[model samples]
Target: MTPHDNLGYQRLFDDGLSFGVGFPLTNQNDTMPDVDEELRLARHAESVGFDALWARDVPTYWPSFGDAGQTFDVWPWLTQVATVTDELALGTASVVLPLRHPLHVAKAAATVDQLSGGRLVMGIASGDRDPEFPAFGVELSDRGTLFRESVELLRTVWREDYPEVESSWGTLDGEITLVPKPTTETVPLLPTGYARQTLEWIAEHGDGWLFYQLPQSTLESYLADWRDAAGDTPFSMAVQVELADDPGDGPEHIHQGFCAGTEWFRDYFSGLNEMGVDHVLVGLQSDDPEADLSRFADEVISPRS
Candidate 1:
């Protein structure tokens, strides 16, 4: 078996396209979520065959942004979910790399990776929230540099026991060591968006890519570019969906996704498969998420699986 077979999320990409569910499993857009219900839906997703459960890292809730993104700190929430579910991958749709200290991020991520038994896949970003930069005291202009350095730091700390390393962030003097290393050789890192880096840089460094929804034409174009730069590194995207009650309803554009019936989703996902998409993180909007999840599993995921 290869390294891909050893990592939970990587396994999902081995064969063909696999599906995952993003957090805030319900349609309730409130800043706070009913934690119990979210957990219930998460486990149900696993039981029904979703490959992974993704959480967003929103350290502060900017009212203007309009979504709190599962409304819980990603580390604790994911660790708790890991205890209850088996074999389902736990991911951070993105942890803002430039905003937080790379050491803290490294330690926390490794802790989760160890606790989850190698199930963690971190999706990192340079951050796009304008207000967050100043609040964190991170310069927006230097984010691209900070982002690159942070990635290097994370890899160095995780892969080496203790090595002398210096960066604008800080210095590791080979005296201190990060404990509880990842269960695997290294934790998989997928960069979200461009993270202010060129496509070639991201392709050369990232384990995978986490992208927002895009139109088919645009996505095809992006994938073509990515393949040339990254060669078979998995590419994943998120889509929001409101499953119409009718199985025949066609797709209608919605916020970053579409409102569609089961048949339409099936065909849509199939097209994605043909396009060489490795995985998709589905964000569902429904009054009854549990029922909707089951229906989606039976209709869309099952056929594709």
Candidate 2:
């Protein structure tokens, strides 16, 4: 069977246009989240009908970068999340391919998928953090090449048992097998943000495409290009939103998204679906997590989903 028939794909993309919460679900990220509270929000998101929960993989926090990576590591954190929620897709917003070994990634991913009962979607990327490249001893320039090779290696090891392969990292002499293959035929790999490859290459290889926030007209152009090469493969994008209390508040432009009211968001989602977007990763930027989460579910997600 094809990758789209996988349970995560069916749950996340087939039922209708689905909405998911990008993690650290609280916009009030002033301090590290309490474990209990974070898990509660995760479970809350599931109850409220979020299709998936995405985790970010930031290896070493660069203070100058203004990003601490993530409070917890991607695999263990997702494993914990898998324990708390039943149906939500547990995803890595992306794992940097150039930094880590593919065998390890495959093993960890399969483990999570097995534990999660086959609900995992991986977003793969050629990383962009400058300091990260040197620290990991990876050449920043060859990221695009490494990104392609990594993808090829992952598919081979995951699908072919004891497969003989020679790769940049090392040669697999077809001696040992990687255990706990993904519950699906293979994990769905969505390439995020071009990953230093041509759109044609991404369209040909990726299970789907994961993009970032874009202006409306630009999005239309991008999706048009996607359809030309990728055809019906799914597309997902992330957006930042500051939910205003008023139903008619301004659609004020923000960095990657908008500060808007519920009604405006509802219409915006509709426009997105019409433009061939299969899923949206909502980054809620408001102060009240519980309240905004529920409201978004009731308004934007309910009608479309």
The residue pairs that clash in candidate 1, if any, are: none
**Tens-digit lDDT track of model 2 for 63-134:** 676654446788999999999999878888889999999989989998998899888899999997899898
lDDT of each: 0.88, 0.86
Q: Which stretches of candidate 2 lie over 4 Å from their true place?
A: 28-31
Which residue runs does candidate 1 get wrong by more than 4 Å? 1-5
lDDT of 1 by residue, 219-266 (tens): 999999999999999999999989999999999999999999999999
TM per candidate comes to 0.97, 0.97
Candidates' RMSD to native: 1.3, 1.3
Q: How many clashes in candidate 2? A: 0
